[model samples]
Target: MAKLFTPYKLKNMELKNRVVMPPMCQYSVDTKDGMPNDWHQVHYISRAVGGTGLIIVEMTAVHPDGRITDQDTGIWDDRFIPAYRQMVDAVHSYGTKIGIQLGHAGRKAEDANPPVAPSAVRYDGEGYKEPRALTTAEVEEMIEAYAEGARRAVEAGFDTVEIHGAHGYLIHQFHSPLVNQREDEYGQDLPLFGERVVQAVRKVVPADMPVIMRVSAREYVDGGYDVDYITEVCRRYRDAGADIMHVSSGGEGPVGAGGMPVGPGYQVEMAAQLKRALDMPVIAVGILDEYEDAEQVLENDQADLVAIGRAMLRDPYWAVHAAKALQAEADVPVQYARGYRH
Candidate 1:
């Protein structure tokens, strides 16, 4: 049997396979109320039916101002629970475990009235404006918001919850020295924000529910943090109750600082390093879209799971097709079984 189709357990959660559908923002909430409409229902359910082992819903904002765009999903209100419940129910029917990535965009919130960040600096690029620094009080409020988001995620019946601490979002802003220039505790203790958020979310979820963290292991700019710094950050997250880490790099700033080498399985080594450094399970992302490559990562113990973003977006059946290609047994939906040749 291929490692890609092997069962992997994180605490009490058991995924049927190593394939993970990492959060990729759909930005489909047309009402601006942060509700998931029909588009989201079909978008996520199809992947569940297509044999994805775990479907992590996209970056869901904990506050309206936290949205990267007006269209991003939000869990800020109780009313949004039912919509998410419906999506969860549909995905569950196909026997797939589901998770949601809770986040606040901060300086990257292009649609915000005025974005907020850990510092008053503007993101260095067009399409991004200077953001007001989050006051210490507001920072505390955001922590509670994350806790509330986790509570709502539980109410909606998700099996796991991921805190988006990567990609230069609010948590990343606080974690990255280049973006965070405050003299307060947040600046002096850079990983404090992410650690607190993890602790907050962990408190709200079921004791057995796994809390995953997505982190940028390496920033692509000079003076930007690298794997060594992020490993220590991951240590903080683990101490704060994070069960797993999803490894991805570069979003803290513009990517022009001697671009990272891009290719298949480019980020696998980072995951391997974190796994060894922290003795924790991690999800290896970044171009490990091919089944063979994903299987190799698992077989080599580089990561516990593999996340395919662009490939999964292009084809919801990326997992099902991979099962066929790898000649591994996959629980293909009964209705679609006829399409799979013997």
Candidate 2:
């Protein structure tokens, strides 16, 4: 059996394979209520039936105004727990572990009358609104929001909780020197906000369930932080109780003099660096959709897990196909077994 198919355990979460369906926003909340409707459930459960080992649900806002758009999901209140629990129970029936990425869009909140960020910097995009700097009290409030979100995720019976600190969101804005220009403690210490978020999330979650922190390990903006600097930032997150780092790059925008790398496994080396630097498990993402490309990451020990975003979006049965291609043992759904034969 290929190493990718081998059972891998992180904390108390045991995955049947190394394949991870990273969080990708579906923007399906047409009702503007931030509830995970039937569409969201079917979207994820289909992948669960397709043989994915773990599925990280898309960015779920920790606050109402923290959404990128009205269509994104939010879990700011206790009312969302029952609905999330319903989806979680169904996904579990397929023998797959599921998690939710708790995030706040911050300056990227398109509908916000005035988006909030660590600083008053605009996202440098046309549709984005200029953001106001978060006051110290509001920053503290956001931290509590993250904790409450995790508490709700626990109630929903999610296997784990991932803090979406990547992609220039609220947490990312606080950590990025390019975006954060505050004079307060948060500005003085870039990783402070993210570290506090991890600590807060760690408090609400079970001791055995690992806290995953997804971060942009490398920024694409010309003056953005490099892999080494971001690695150190992630080191603080690890110390703050983040058990795993979901390594991804870019999202700060504008291709710099050094362009963003494209093609297969481009971010593998960065994930490998973080894994070595932090000495903890890391999930590598970035065009790693091919079966062999995903396998080699595990085979060569570049990362602990590989995330396939676009590929999984295109085919929910991706994991099943990869299992067949690699000739590895996978729990193909009994209903679909006949369809998977070579």
C-alpha RMSD values across all candidates: 0.9, 0.9
Q: State the lDDT of candidate 1 residue by residue for 176-202, as single tens digits.
A: 989889999999999999999999999
How high is the CA lDDT of each candidate model?
A: 0.93, 0.92
TM-score (C-alpha) between model 1 and the true structure: 0.98
Please give each candidate's TM-score. 0.98, 0.99
Would you give me the overall lDDT of model 1?
A: 0.93
- C-alpha-based local distance difference test score of model 2: 0.92
Q: What is the Cα-based TM-score of model 2?
A: 0.99
> Could you tell me the lDDT of residue 157 within candidate 2?
98
Off by over 4 Å in 1: none
